[model samples]
Target: MAKSRFRSTTEHTMDSKGRLNFPSRFREVLNQYDSEILMVAPWGKNHLRAFPLPEWEILEDRLMTEGREKPDLANFIRYVVGGVAECSLDKQGRVQLPVQLRTKVSLAKNIMLVGMIRHVEIWDKEIWQQDNEATSENFDSFNEQLSQMGIF
Candidate 1:
């Protein structure tokens, strides 16, 4: 059986308490895992990535085993692994974004939850807009790259 993947995007506002509704579509995908928790962590300077517990474990295992002696990999493990937060979905279908994680990613009121196949990305709305625009402008080049990679 094929693994369920996240898809599409949704715009939402983080409440004053730092809680945002987890998109139902994303929840549907998560449901297949039989897990209620997400391993939320910083994806970059401006966004966060959330993985289901099982997926996070797979990644964590690889990070621990494959690059234990590499300095660059150690730094990555420090930043990404150290910053992970286990966020549980509340009954209201909202997940509380930890303050430190939010600050690390520069997230605030306006947010964008983007489906990234294996994981979900939570982006600051403004940053996502600028990045999306740049990607749109460079689509032809990106399309060629994708085609070269046999994606199309």
Candidate 2:
């Protein structure tokens, strides 16, 4: 049986057509959602987040309802929710990433698909390397915070 959540990271290459061979392990997680559609959107400064259709709807609904009163949150919704691209995997397990979306994050030849629990993150290979290194640098502080929260 497939696992309930997405985890781990996998390297991938985008074809000239901008299609990526979606990882098989992540596809197993998608099966649990019973949906072929993925809502891909810009995340943070340098990555894209892909959510299953159902999950995307849930998030969209929340953004619509909760972002009404908060200016900062509304801005966030504008960036993340407004740029979503609906995508589906082809028979060969490749998904066609929109040119605009790909360009936004500078995704070119090499990329990384990162399992982010409920969603998956797509990052440029070089950017991910730099970001991962920066995160690793602060691991001790993060670990201490997690421990303080009773998570470690």
Candidate 3:
């Protein structure tokens, strides 16, 4: 499988009113495509997830693959469905995060946008700092363990 070329990362701040000024580089990535996008507050995390419309469709398809008889899948879909919102960039190249998402991520002043292969994760500054620290501390050991699995 081909790896996605959309990986990018940026740190930014959200204003007191919960509006974020997305980085220009990140905006450039979005501009390369013509499509609406969906931003969602993923479960069990204090962050927002942004997915291009096409990518979101793929995710939805994957979710649907879970058997209808599975209660966990149903519950997962309910939470994900309610947390997702369609968004678009304004002239200033900013997207207004929904109030719930902003609150979910505790996004007030400092924010970080971390690009994964197919999506972006929005995190609060303090939380990102702590998470980064934890990841850094365990990265070497994590990689070693993964290597043992022959999956690294």
Which of the numbered candidates is closest to the native, going by highest TM-score?
Answer: 1
Residue 5 local lDDT, model 1: 95
lDDT for each residue of candidate 3 in 25-119, tens digit (9 for 90 to 100): 66666655556454555654677788877778888877777646576777678777677888876777677787877876677677888888677
Tell me the tens digit of each residue's lDDT in model 1 across 1-152: 87779999999999999999999888988999999899999876989999999999999988878877666888788889999999999999999999999999899899999999989999999999999999899888877778899996
Tally clashes: model 3. Answer: 0
Model 1 segments more than 4 A misplaced? none
For all candidates, the clash counts are 0, 0, 0
> What is the Cα-based lDDT of residue 71 in candidate 3?
66
Local distance difference test scores for all models? 0.92, 0.90, 0.72
Worst 10 residues of 1 by lDDT: 66-75
Q: Sort the predicted structures by TM-score, highest score first.
A: 1, 2, 3
TM-score of 2: 0.93
Which candidate has the top score in lDDT?
1
For model 3, where is the 10-residue window of minimal lDDT? 35-44
Quote the positional error of residue 61 for candidate 1 in Å.
1.2
lDDT of 2: 0.90
Candidate 3: which pairs clash?
none
